[model samples]
Every structure is written in C-alpha cells, then in structure tokens.
Target: MNLKTVVVGAGGISNAWFPPLIQEGIEIAAVVDLNIETARAQIKKYELKAVASIDLEATLEQHRPDFVIDLTIPEAHREVTITALQAGYPVLGEKPMATNMDDAREMVRISTDTGKMYAVSQSRRWDKNHDILRRTIESGVIGKVTAINCDFYIGAHFGGFRDEMSSPLLLDMAIHHFDMARFFTGADPIAVYAKEYNPVGSWYKGDAAASCIFEMTDDIVFTYVGSWCSEGCHTSWNGNWRVIGEKGTLIYEYDKAPYGEVVESDTTDFHRPLKKADITDSPLEAFGMHGAICEMIDFLKTGKTPQTECKDNIKSLAMVFSAIESAKRRQRILVEL
Candidate 1:
C-alpha cells in the first residue's frame, strides 16, 4: 500500500527517512520546513516527485496525507505532532517524543482524544544485535534476570546544537539505551539516582558524562555509565551490556556477536559448575531506521501498533527526564510516568 505522508523538518535526519519510506512504496506528499529552500533542496537531492512548502497546514490541507512524519527537533515535536494528530493524521515521530514530560503527556492525551496513532521511531530497537540480546534474555537462557549493566564511551565532535545543550549525553543520547533497557527487560523504571559531570578535557558546554542507577520493576537494577567526549577506548554505540540472571549471565560485547552461557549448579561444591553454553546468533531482517519505518507503515496499513507508541514511549522519556532531574537535584528521583 502506498501511504501518502507529509514530513516536517528538512534537516540532516530527514535524509535518512525518505529511502525507507520509498522502499516501502510510501509516497511523499510534500516536505515542509520553516525554510522553504531547505525543503526544496531535499526534494532536489532525493529526486522526489513531491512539492516543498513552508506551511504545514496548507500542505496538509491540500494533499491530505494519511499520516505525518515528524522529523522536527525535540522542542518542536509537541507542536508538529499535535497539529497533525488534530488535523486527522497519525504521526510517526522522532525520538524523545518531546522536550520534556509535560509536553510528552499532552501529546499522548491528544493522540487518545483524536484516536490517531502516534509512534516514536526508536530506531535503536531495530538493531539486529539488540534484538538478539533481548530474545536471549527473554528466553530464560540465563534464568530470571536480576540486573543489567551498560557502558558507553564515545569521543564525538558534533559541533552543532549538541555542543550548546546542557546534559548533552543524558538528553541527546541516553534515551536509546534507556529505552533498550526497558525493551530488554520488559520493565518500567521506578526510580533513578544519577550524577552528571563534565570531564576535565571535555569540550561540551554542559555535562557530557553521566552515571545512573535505575530501579526497574521486578527488582531489576540497571546501571549505566557513558561519556560523549572520551578520547579513547570507545565502546559500541549500542554499548557493552551484561545481563545477569539467577542461573547464568548473558554478555554482549562491543563490535562482537552476542552470546550466552548457562551453568549447571550442584549442592556438592560452594561454587556452581560451568557448562558448555549453547550459543546462538540472532540476525535482523532489517536494521535501524529502516526497520522502524517499515513497522510504522505496517501499523498504518494493518492497525498493528508499533512497539514505541507514544503512550508506551513516554515511560522511556520519563527515564531521561528523571535522570537529568536526579542529576540536577543531586538526589534520587522517582520516575513520574
């Protein structure tokens, strides 16, 4: 089915969006941006048979797209999404849902009021390795999960808006890992105590490093440490994850395949006996943004809800906000979902 979509925001991210939609046979009705020339440039770059517009309302009214793809920046997400949902279009939006919890809650309320679907494109969820890790843990190969740990270190030099933001790592990047934690464990965050700091040699205006401890449902403890301005020994963008359960442990290393090991315990000895692990590799049918776009298109056609629907995704956003809040307050904060 060719779903006609109006995409708002003609930024760098907008470039990654179109190929996936086109692959799914979705038609781009028009591209809208505050700068019409920017929208026109994207049209020319992609060779799209679509028009460019500075006015979203006028474009939507004229073309009447089946859905809206909100590619706007974090602050503008609420307005762009609310406008489209109220205008009778479902929205597939970029991550963080909104700049803050108040805006995110309002977006969810509008989706319910309008009865239109609003799904956040949590593109990381589409990674094949992450999917493999989730499946392995959920399979109980290591028994009931008790704790999870993730470490991410990168020395990025993104000299744009990110450099100007406060708590850049927590706000701009941690949501993916936080959401992945939720997805991997099927648990919601209860509380978090976090600390954000700027390393001595860091270049960002705000904290680019953070350590957070989260209490999730089912008594799971998730620990995360990350740095966006570390100069060396960078971890995978997906991070190095260790999921510990009652029986065994599952480890996902950076730039390596994921694997698990189950040990057999005997009452005879104090320590449990280790057994040969039956290792398996989980592969992806599609990865990253492409997979999420495919899922969004399927939801539009078949009414199959995307995993990161606005209501569910708000919890993930809550984790981000709570972490930042905890850091600012220098105390533990309950994740107010």
Candidate 2:
C-alpha cells in the first residue's frame, strides 16, 4: 500500500526526513508548521504534491494520512505527538523523545491507550556498522559482555538553541549513544551516576561535556565520556567503543568496521592465547534516517514492531533523564520507568 502521511514541523530537520519519504514512494499529504511559509517552502523545495498548513488539527481533520511524521523541536515533541496519536494517527518522531521523563511517560501511556504506533527516529541505531557490532556482540564470539565504554569528542559549533540550553551535550546529543548502548547490550539501565560540566573555552553556553557511569541489566557496566567542545583528535559521531566480555573484547573505532579477539586456548601462561574474530556487516535495507523510515513502513505493512517503538524507546530516554538527575544531585539515581 502507498501510505500517506502528514508531516508536522518543517524546520531544518525536515529536510533529512523528506528525501527518505520520497525515496520510499510514500505520499506526503500535507506539511504542518507554526510558520506556514516554512512548510510551504519545504513542499516547494522537494516538489511535493502536498499542502501546507499552520494548524495540525485542521490538517488532520482534512487529511486521513497513514501516520504523522513529527520533526518539531524537543519541547514541541510531546504536544505534537500526543495530538496526532489522539487524533487516531500513528506518529514517527525525531528523538530526545521529550524534554522530561514525565512527558515521555505520558506520551507512552497515550500511545498504548490509543493503540497507535509511536516510534522515535533514533537514526544512529540503523547504521550498518552499528548493526554489525550489535550482532557480533550478541553472537557470543566475545563471550558474555560485562563492561561497555564509549568516548565521543567533537567540537560542534551549532549556533542555535543547543548553544544556550543547559545540559546540551547530554540532552541534545548523548541520547544517540545512550540508545546505541541499549541496542548493543540489550540491557535497560538500572541506575546512573553522572557529572556534567562546561569545558574551558567551550563555545556552547551550557554544560557541553559529561561523564556517566550507568548500571545496566545483567550487571553490565556502561560508561560514557563525551565532549562537544573537544578541539582535536575527535572520535566518530558513533563514538569509539570497547565492549569487554568474560573471554574476550570487541573494539569499534573511527567509524570503521568492528573487530575483536577471543581466547584461542587455555594455557598455564599469564594470558590465554587469542585469535582474531572478524565482524561481518549485517544486511540492512537502508541506513540512518532512511533505515528508520523503512522500519516504520514495514511496521505499517506488517504487524512487526519497529525497534524504537515508544514503549522501548522510553527506556533510552530514561537513561538521558536519569543521567541529568544524577549530575544534579551528585548521587546515583535509579532508572525508573
């Protein structure tokens, strides 16, 4: 079926979403934004046969699309998604799920009550390398994973709301890494101890750096250290990963394919002999945003649940909020809900 959608929010992020929707041959019925001109401009830029509207309720009343693509800003996510879900349309939204846990929980509750699919576009999880890393770890080649460490350092100079918001790195960026941690470990957070700060000479006005230690399910330890203001020797946006298991370890760095080593033989020597373990790329229908869109499309066509469905995605969002709370109280916070 050629699904139709009403896209809510036509800001800069919408550009990243439009191409994938077009590629999939999904019809965009309309684009809704507070700035009608912005929505109109996006429609024209993409040469979409879609209407531009300023009001979501009015647009929803007029067009019964298959779903709503919510590209609104973080603060607007809860309102836009709840409105669409309540109006009886499934919604695919940009990440950071909501500004706070209360809103995130409420959105999840409404999605369940309405029986509508509300999925977050956690674009990073769809990457092929990420998929392979997840598969390799799960394949038991590295034995049972005990600890996971990630380091992200990039000198981002985005001169927008990010430059001014408090906990910009944790709230605006680290959610991707946090979600990926869950994807790889298949573990939900149990508790978190974190410290957030603004590094010297940082361009962003808020706390642009953070170090968090998360206690995950199965007694797994996941540590994340990141800086949005580091000037040199930057790591990949996916971050550098080192996943340690009982019998071996896997390392992924610089956006390259991951490789690992496992115990080859049991010996009386100080260290057991090790052998190289190759990580092959797992097949993906698409990558990044396009990949996420494919999952939503498949979910609509079939009854299969997408990985980032609100109920599951909320746990990742909880990690972000819990980290912030831990940073604030200078105490470990339990991950609830």
Candidate 3:
C-alpha cells in the first residue's frame, strides 16, 4: 500500500515522526507549519520528497493525503483534526488529544460522524517493559492487580513553552503517566483527587510537581507522584512502578529489567513465605514513538484499530483534566468519561 501523509507541524517532534515514516516507506506529501521556514528546514534536513507550506488546509486540499499527521501543539489539535476528518482523512496525532475535554469530544464526534480513524500517540504505551508488565498482570502471574503506584522525578530545564505554563507538570507531562497507569491497570478512570505545588528553587512559573490519586474502574487505585524540578536521583522518564496483586508484586524501572516475586499463602497475616519467580520481558517490534507510528501505519493499511483511538484516548485525557480540576477545587472530581 502506498501511503501519503501530510504532517501538520514542523517542530522538533516532527523530526521524530519522520524516521519511522521513511523506514515504513510512507511518503510525506507535505510539511505544514505557521512558519514556512521551519517547514522548509525540515524538508531540507530530511531531503524529503515533499514540499513545505504555511497552510494545513491548502496542503490538504492540494495533496488529498491518504492520512494526516497532526503534530501541531495541543491547542491546534482540535482544529487540525477536524479539518482533516472533514476532508475524509484519518489522523495520527500527538497526545493530550486536545486542549480540553469539550474540544476532544468534538473531535471524537467528527471522527464518529465521518467514520474515520483518529488516533492519539500515547507513545509511552509502546515500551517493551510496559508491554511486559501489562501482559504479566493480565496473565495473572501476580494474580488480579489491586493497586499501582508510579514515582517520577526529573529536573527538566527546557527553556520554552513548558516553563511558562500553569500546572506545568500536570498539564504537559503527567498525561503520559496517567495514560500509562490506565493501560497498566486495564481500567478507565473513575475519580481523581490531586494537589499541586511549586517547590522552592523551581524555575517554572507554575506548579512543577503534583501528587494524584485516581480511583479507576474495577476498584483499582492508581497513585502518581511526580516532580519536574527536583534534582538528584531522578527517575526514568517512564518512572518507577510498583504493581500489587493478590499473590505477589511486579516492579519495573525504566532503565533496568522488570521482575516479579510471589509469596506463598500462609496463615500468618503479617509475615508470609517468599518466593522468587522468573519474569521475562515482552519485547517490542519497535520502541517509543516509532512503535506508535508503526501501529498507525498498520491501522491505515489493515483496518486494525490503534490502541489510542480518540474515543478511547478521551478517557486518558479525562484523567489529566480531572486531576487539574481536583487540584483547583481541593476535592475529588468525578471523571466524566
């Protein structure tokens, strides 16, 4: 199948999307950005068999691509996605789906009305370790999962739009962990209570750290603790995780191998017999962003549904927004997914 795609944003992330497209032998029909020069630079840098344009609609109208890659910022996602869906094109876009739930629902509505696929790239779900953990829990090696906790700490110093946003950690970064928590637990969000704070010596204008507790479907509790401005012993971008089940626990670190241990059932309530269980990683065909694009490509060709389809991704976005709402209201917010 010959696939021609229009990528709507020519920022740094577009660079990441290109290699996979090239490897998959997909054609870039055009690159579009508000700044034509930025798009031109991408075309030049990649030696793309493509053109650069400042207008997404114009390029889409001209090329009539098989699909659209909406790499634009969060605020632009709804418009870009709607325009493409209206144009009868499927979309593989970056995450946070849209700036807010209303816009997200609108995009999903358009896709539903148009019968087109709109997938959000929840890239973290493509990790080998995460995939392994998900499978292990599903296989009931540790028995039915009851709770999950993730700890993330990073001293990110990106001096751009991120440093200027309010609730920077929750808005910009926490969505990945939130989405991953849902994937790991295989549950949709039910409710959330959260608190945000800006630690002293933090460079960000808004809160750079947060603690969120989400009650998920099936009585699962997912807790996330993250900081974007803490120094020393930073966790992996994927964070450190502990998944507790009825019989045992699964532990995963971003850089190291994930493992599980089982405890023998005994009469003692506090103390139990320990057992070391063999745990194996379920490797990925591709890693990170590339893996996500691969799935999108497969969806376009074979009509397989991507895991982060907009209808489903709204649940993940709901988790992010509910956490923000909880932080602001100082109360548990029911997720409206």
Candidate 4:
C-alpha cells in the first residue's frame, strides 16, 4: 500500500525525512509547521502536491493522513506526537522523544489510550555496521558482555540552540550513542553516575563535554565519554566503541568495520591463544533515516512493532535524562522509565 503521511516541522531535519518518504512511495499529504511559509517552501522544494499549513489539527482534518512524521525540535515532540495520536493517526517522530520523562510517558500513554502506533526515529539504530555489531555480540563471539565503552570527540561549532543549552552534548547528541548502547547490548539502563562539564576554550555557552557511567541490565556497564568542543583528533560521529565480553572484545573505531579477538584455545593455560575475529556487515535494505522510515512502513503494513516504538524508546530517553540528573546531583541516579 502507498501510505500517506502529513509531515510536521519544516526545519532542516525535516529535509532528511522527506526524501526517504518519497523513496518509500509514501505520499506527502501535507506539511505542517508553526510557520506556514516555511511549510510552503518545503512543499515547493520537494515539488509536492501537498498543502502547507500552520495548524496541525486543521491539516490533519483536511488530509486525514495515514500517519504523521514528526521532525520537530525536541521541545515540540511531545505536543506534536500526542496531538497526532489522539487524532487517530499513527506517528513516527524524531529522537530524544521529549524534553522530559513525564512528557515522554504521557506521549506513550496517549498512544496506548488512542490505540495508535507511536515510534521514535532513532536513526542510528538502523546502520548496517551497528546491526553487525549487535549481531556479532549476540552470536556470543565475545561471550557474555561485561562492559561497553564509547568515546566521541568532535569540534563542532554549531552556533544555534545547541550552543546555548546547559547540557548540550548530553541533551542534543549523546542520546544516539545511549540508544546505540541499548541496541547493542539488549539491556536497559539501571542507574547512571555522570559528570557534565564545559572545557576551557569551548565556544558553547553550556557544558559541551560529559563522562557518563551507566549500569545496564545483565550486570553490563556502559561508559560514555564525549566532547563537542574538542579541537583535534576527532572521532567518528558514531564514536569509537570497545565492547568487552567474557570470551573476548569487539572494537569499532574510526568508523571502520568492527574487529576483535577471542581466546583461540580452551586450554587452562594462564594465557590462552588468541585469534582474530572480524565483524561482517549485516544486510539492510536501508540505513539511517531511510531505515527508520522503512521500519515504520513495515509496521503499518504488518502489525509487527517498530523497534523504536515510544514505549521502548522511553528507556533510552531515560538514560539521557538520568545522566543529566546525575550530573546535577553529583551522585548516581536510578534510571526510571
């Protein structure tokens, strides 16, 4: 079926969603934004035969789209999603689900009350290499996962909202890595102890660096160290990963393919022989935003739940908020979804 959707938010991020929607044969029934002209420009840019409106309710009533794609800023995510779900339209929204856990939970509640599917587009979860990393760990090549470490360093000078936020890196960016940790380990966050700071010579007004230690389920420890203001020797946007398990470890660094080594011999020697283990890319029809769009499409076609459905995604969001809270309290905080 050729699904029809009304996309909300005509900001830069919305651009990423449109092409994927078109490629999936999903019709752009309308574009809704706070600025009607911005919405109109988006429709024009895409050469879409869709109406542009500033009012979501009016647009929904007119188009009655099959679903709603929410590309709004994090602050607007809850409102947009709740409105769409309550109006009986399934919604696929951009990440960081909501500004706060209360709002995130309410969005999930509305979706359940309305019996509509509400999923978050955690774009990183769809990467082929990420899939491979996940599968490799699941394959037990590394045995029981004990610890997962990620280091993300970048010299980003984005002069907009990100530069002004208090916990810029933790709030705006680290959610992806946090979600990826959940994706790789199949574990939910248990507790978090974090330290958020602003480094000297940083351009951002708020803390652009953070070090977080998360206690995940199955006794797995996940540590994240990142900086948005680091000047040199930057890491991949996906960060460098080191996943340690009982039998061996998997290292994904410099955005290259992941590789590791495991004990080659089961001998009781003090130091057993080690052998190389490389991760092969798993087949994926699409990656990033396109992958998320495809998953939403599949969910609509079949009753299978999309991976980042609101209920499931809230756990990842919890990790983010918990870390922030931990930073504030200067103590470990329990992650409550």
Candidate 5:
C-alpha cells in the first residue's frame, strides 16, 4: 500500500524520522516548516522528494498526506497535532507528548474525536537497553519486580525553554523513564509523593531537581530522580533502571547510541558496564527508524494504533505532571486518572 507521508518540522532531529518513512515505502508528500530555508536544506541533505511550504493550511491542502509527522517543539505540540487531527490526519509526533497534561489530554481527545491515530515518539520503548531489562524480568531471574529507580541527569547548556527555570526534568525527560517503568513492571501508578528544589545555581522557574516516589498496585514502587541542572558529567541508561524482583535483580545502564550496558545481579553497581547479551544488528542509525516503520505498518495493515497513543502515554504523562503538581504543593498528591 502506498502511504502518503508529510513531515511537519525541519530542524535538529528531523533527519532521524526519514529512513523509516522511506523504508516503509511511504511517499514523501511534503516537508513543511515555518522556516522554508531550513526545510529546503533538510530536503536537500536527505535527498527527499518534498516541496517546502510556509503556511500550514496551504501545505496541508497541497500535500493531502495520509499521515502527518509533527516534529515541532514541545510548546507547539498541541497546536500542530490538534490541527492535523481536526483535518483528519494521523500524527506521529516527537515526545513529552505535550509540555503539560491539559494539552496532552486535549491532543488525545482530538485524535479520538476525529478518528486519527496519534502517537508519541517514545522510541526508547523499543531500544535494546529496555528490551534486555524487560527480558530479564520476564525470565523471573528477578523474582518479583518490587521496586524501580531511574535517573536522567546531564550537564548541558541547550539554552532554550529547557534551560529555563520552568523546566521539570520529569516532564522534559523522565516521562520516558516513567513510561518504561510501567512498561517493564506492567503496573499502573496509584499515588505519588514528590519533592522538588532549585538550588540558587540554576536556570528555570521549575525545580532544578525533582524526585518522585510512585506507588503502583501490588505493592510495587517507582522512585525517580530527574534534573537538567547538575555539575556531574552527563549520564543516563534510557530507562537506566534497577528492578528488585522477588527472586533476583536487573539493572540497565545507558550512555546513548552504541554505548549502553546492562548488568543483572542482586547487588548494585551504579556505574555498571553494558551486558554482553546477544545484541542484534538492528539498523539503528536509521535511527531506530524501524519503530516508526512498525507503527506505520501496523496502522496500514491492522488499523490499530501502536503503543505511542496519547491515551496510553497519558498515564505516564500524568505521572510527570503529577510530580510537578506535587512539587508545587510541597506534599504528596493523589494522581487523578
């Protein structure tokens, strides 16, 4: 089947989405960005068959794409995604879903109301680091997943909305970890108690570091430490998770592309090395382009939306915004589904 595709953003990570579209046999209907020059540059760089357009309405009318990829900024997420859904187009956007929960809910609603597939690019769910973590737990090498802890700490000056004081590491980054925790444990969060603080040495109105403790059903727990403002040498393991099951334990460490490690043992080695498991020769520089390929293929054949659904990810998103609310209230807050 010929799937007509359009990519709606043309900056940094836009290149990452292309190989999948190409590999999945989707037609490059158009590539639209407010900055036509940047869009043209990307079109040239990737050798895509696309026309750059300045206006959304004009571009949509011109392309009439079967699917629209919203790769815009976090704050612009709802606007771009809702517009596409309202116009009867499915959206596979980059993540955080939306910068906040209210908009996240609205994005989900628009998709549901309009019958369009809306998926977040929570691609880490398909990463080998996470796959190993999931496998170890399923093998029962770890008796029962009693608890999980994750962290996303880095030192970078990506001066923008992210560096601002209003940034919540939980919202901006940890949603991946939060979602993965639930994915790995297969449990929903029941309640959350969180603490947030911004030492005088930081950049946003939001906390510099936010720690959240989530209570899942069956007595399982999730604890997260998230921060964008830190002096430490940057590090993370996608989920960077440690699971304490009834029988044993599983740990995964990530350093992004081609450098992640997982160590499964009852004891903890915070700075552990990547496991020598049977790593596959997945064409990841296609940028795990295959996840989007899987998504598009499923939508075309099964007519069922994939895991990135706003409805499904909204739960993980709730954990993120709830932690922020708990931070604001300075008390544990009950998460409202």
Candidate 6:
C-alpha cells in the first residue's frame, strides 16, 4: 500500500524521520515548515515531491496526503494536529503530545471525533532494549512484578523553551520512562504523587529534577526520576530500568545494545551480571533510520496507532501534569488518567 504523506515542520528529528518514510512505502507528497528555505532544503535533501510553505491548509489542499506528520515545536503541536485531524487525515506527531494536559486531551478528542489515527513519536517504546525488557516481563521470569524504576537525566538542553518553562524534568522526558514502566508491567496507574524542583542551572525547563511515585493497577508500584539539567548524560534516555518482582529482579541498562540483563524468578538472591540471551538478533535500535521505519511499517501493516495504543505514554503524560499541580500546591496531587 502506498502512503501519501505530508511532513510538517522540518526539525532536527526530521533528519531521522525522512529516510524511513521513503523506505517504508510512504510517499512524501509535501513538506511544510515556517521556513520555506528549510522546506526547500529538506525536499532537496531527501529528494521529495514537496513544495515549501508555512500554511498547512495550502499544503493539505494541494497534496491531499493520507497522513500529516507534525514535527514542529511543542506550542504548535495542537494547532497543526487539530486542523489535520478535523480535515480527515491521520496524524503522527512528536511527544509530550502537547505542552499541557488540556491540549493533549483536545488532540485525542479531535482524532476520536474525526475517526482518524493520531499517534505521537514516542519512539523509545519501540527500542530494542526496552522491547527485550517488555518481553521478559511478559515471560514472567520474575514472578509478578512489584515495582518499576527509570532514570532519564541530561546535563543540558540549552536556555530555550525547555529551560524557561518551569515544567518538571519528569513531565518533559519521563513520559517515555513512565510509559515504559506501565508497558512492562501491563498495569495502569491509579494515582500519583510527585516532587519536583528546578535546581538553579542553565538548561531547558528551569525545573531541573523530579521524582514521581505511582500506584499502578493490581498494586504494582512505579517510580520515575528525570533531569534535563543534570551534570552529565549519566543515563540513557530510554533509561536504565530495573523491575523488581516477588521472586526475581530484572535489570536492563540503556547503554547496552540488547540492553536486557534479566535475573530469572528463582535466581533472586544475588546481583550477578546478566548473561546476554542469544536470541534472534534484533533490528530494533532507533539510532539511525530503522526506528522510524519500524513505526511506519507498523502503521502500514497493522493499522495500529503505536504511541496512542501504548498505555504508558498517556500515564506518563498524566504523571507530568500531576507533578505540575503537585509542585504548585506543595502537596501530593492525585493524577487522573
């Protein structure tokens, strides 16, 4: 099946997004961005059949793409996506689906109203290491998971949108971690309590650090920690994850390729090194172009809204919004998912 595609807002991630569209049976019908020059540059760079423009309407009318991929900054996410969804087109955009919970809700609402697929590029969910961890949890090597943990820390994001805003690091980057935790446990969070602080530093999102504790369905507990203004890239964005269960513990490091170091259900006594499992060599890394391809292929074949289907993302986003409310009142807020 040929996918007539329109890619909006040519940004850094588009560098990774374009090649995959080409390989995954998606036809690049148009490329839209505020910078006509950038659009033109992208078209030339990728050899796409697109005209540069700032207006989404003009591009939509001219190209009539089956889907619109919004890759613009956070503020523009809702405007672009709402318009596309209302006009009878599916959307695949970037994450934190929007700047706030209200906007995210609206996007989800519009997509549902229009009966179009709306998904975010919460691409880490498709990572090989995380995929391995997910499988391990399902396989139940650790008998019934009890707790989930993730760490997403970055030294700097520059003094821009992220730094100026007081949003918690957890809200910003931890959504992926949160989503992963829920995905691994196959549980939904019932409530959340969080603590966040913006340690004085030069970085994105003045709020430097945050810790979120969640109560998942079936009494599974999850804790996530994130910092964009930290000292160094100590942890992988996919996060070094640890899942503790009743009888065993599973430790997965993001730095490792097939980043799963699983301790089986009976072997819970000692913290020994994970002997790498020799299974089918996975092509799940999103480092280059494959991750984007994986998403496109899934959409084409399965017709599943990947980011939308993943329960962790919504919970992750809820965690962020809840933390924001909690920080303001200096009280633990209950997250409504």
**Best by TM-score, which number?**
2
Q: Which residue pairs in candidate 2 collide?
A: none
Q: What is the lDDT of residue 20 in candidate 3?
A: 85
Any runs in candidate 1 off by more than 4 Å, and if so which? 267-271, 279-283
Q: lDDT by residue for model 1 over 309-335, one digit each (tens)? A: 999999999999999999999999999
Model 4, runs deviating above 4 Å: 266-271, 278-280
Q: Mind sharing the TM-score for model 5? A: 0.86
Query: Model 1 residue 264 lDDT?
Result: 77
Q: List the candidate numbers ranked by lDDT, top first.
A: 2, 4, 1, 3, 5, 6
- Model 2: per-residue Cα lDDT at residue 44: 99
The lDDT of model 4 is: 0.92
lDDT for each residue of candidate 5 in 40-146, tens digit (9 for 90 to 100): 99889878888887676677877888888888878888988988889888888888888877898888888889988888878777776566556656655556678
For all predicted structures, in order, the TM-scores are 0.96, 0.98, 0.96, 0.97, 0.86, 0.87
User: Could you give candidate 6's per-residue lDDT for residues 100-219 as a string of tens digits?
Assistant: 888888777777778787777777666666676777677766668888887777776554566566674665577667767766778877777777887775445457788778888878
Full-model lDDT, candidate 5: 0.75
Q: TM-score of predicted model 6?
A: 0.87
Highest lDDT: give the candidate number.
2
Pairs of colliding residues, candidate 6: 162-204, 162-205, 163-204, 163-205, 179-312, 198-208
Alpha-carbon runs more than 4 Å astray in model 2? none
lDDT of 6 at 190: 76
lDDT-best of 1 and 5: 1
Residues 1-337 of candidate 4 have per-residue lDDT tens digits of: 7799999999989888888888888999899999999999989999998988889998899988989999988889988998999999999999889888899999999999999999999999888789999999988898999999999999998887788788789878999999999999999999999999999988999899999999999999999999999999999999999999999999988888889999887998898899987565698868889998888888888888999999999999999899999999999999998
lDDT of each: 0.89, 0.93, 0.89, 0.92, 0.75, 0.72
Tell me the number of clashing residue pairs for each predicted model. 0, 0, 0, 0, 18, 6
